[model samples]
Target: MTGASGNVGRQVVEQLVAAGEPVRALSRDPARTEWPDGVETVAGDLVGGVPTEAFNGVRALHLFPAPEGVDAVVAAAVAAGVVHVTVLSSLSASWETDSPLQRRHTVVERAVEGSGLGWTHLRPGMFMTNTLAWAPAVRAGEPVRAPFGDSVAAPVHEADIAAVAVAALLDPARHAGAVHELSGPEALSQRDRVRVLGEVLGREVRFEEQSRAEARADLLRNPWMNEQLADSLLAMQERTVGVRDGLVLPAVDEVLDRPGRSFAEWVADHREAFTGPV
Candidate 1:
């Protein structure tokens, strides 16, 4: 599995391990991460060429979207006798916009679809983990400041995304050629999510809304972010403001035969992130 140490990929690796499947995990630094007893950790870089030996004796592949060499990786997997591939994709891929964020995942999706191998595209909506960025302010006992505080999204749990990917990898026949649009069980505005966090942590968490420019300035604090990417992110959130609550999809529930985790549940699970050491 590629990106075996990542958010969703780590969980995918864990779930596969729990299922007694022999997992060959590809990581840039294999020794940094401790894996379960049977997982074979290998050093490979997706941005650079993924080592061919990583695919040897492998059948189904769990793929992560790397900006470069995606087609080469897929081709290597195909050549190594991989019959099925589950791609980690974004909901933005289905968007009508022409932003790089949308095009990035769509390019990977198109490559996998045209590969003739059995494929499943897991197009998950906003990840609840994205809110972890607010942890520093929350721990500092300050309000979480971001633009589009009123923007609504059905932020999905990373576990659900990994679970769907695991199901597809394990039962390729049942999930092949499927495109799943996943979301949380309910829609919640960014403000509402802060309220949920407050309730879960038993303290009044606060949210301070910023203008688009302010948010862009804040995002630029990251040296990796440029003007265009920051604007695209803000624009994406701006587009979601006031979106209907019922727009939440049921793919997560249908695929797992259970309702997706709620934002409140996510907050409860991550309460410690908002509140530091007691």
Candidate 2:
């Protein structure tokens, strides 16, 4: 699995291991990852060197994109006899759209599709785990602030996302050629999410909305986050497409045999993220 040390990717790796699957985890730094026993580790899958050395005899993969050598890596995965490729894609990917993140990720998807391997794309919406970004402020008793407070999203749990990814990778019969837009069971505004966090933690945490200018100034130092991706996410926050209108899916249940978790439950599980160790 590429990006095995990352957020959602980390959960995928843990789930794969717990399910008794032999996992070969790839990261940019092999020594940095502390994987479970029997899991192989390698570095440099998507950059200069081809790390397909670990892919030899592998039957499945959960892929992510990097700055370079994706094509060569895919080719080597094919030569290594990989049967299924499950890509960790976003909900924003539209083939005809002209967004940079979408453009680049779609290019990677195309490479996988053209590689003649069985593939499934997991398109998850905003992650509930993203709220952990506000944890430090919550711990400090400061209002959680960001642009687009009025925007709504189905804030999906990362565990649910990983559960579905495992289902797709291990059993492709129902998910092949399908795009699953994973989300939480309920639609919530940013303010509402903060309130829920406060409730779960037994503290009345506050939330404030930042203007676009403020967001831009604060994020200027983030070299990896370009303006286009930030703007697109902000816009999605402002006027969300799928919400109470029920554009959501039962894919999680169909794949994992259960409905996705609600934000309240997510907050409860992650109360420690806001409150820290006792």
- Top TM-score model: 1
Q: TM-score for every candidate vs. truth?
A: 0.96, 0.92
Clashing pairs in 1: none
With a 3 Å backbone cut-off (N, CA, C), the pairs that clash in candidate 2 are 151-237
Model 2 lDDT at residue 62? 88
Backbone Cα, N, C clashes tallied per candidate: 0, 1
Q: How big is the positional error of residue 187 in model 2, measured in Å on the Cα after superposition?
A: 0.4
In order, what is each prediction's RMSD in angstroms? 1.5, 2.2
Show where candidate 1 strays beyond 4 Å: none
Task: Please give the distance, in angstroms, between residue 228's alpha carbon in candidate 2 and its true position after superposition.
Answer: 2.2
lDDT of each: 0.89, 0.80
What is the Å distance of residue 117 in model 2 from its true position? Answer: 0.6
Candidate 2 overall Cα lDDT vs. reference? 0.80
Task: Determine which window of 10 residues in candidate 2 has minimal summed lDDT.
Answer: 240-249
Q: Which ten residues in a row have the lowest lDDT in candidate 1?
A: 269-278
Per-residue alpha-carbon lDDT of candidate 2 for residues 35-59, written as tens digits (9 for 90 to 100): 8888888876577675547788789
Runs in model 2 with CA error above 4 Å?
94-97, 241-243
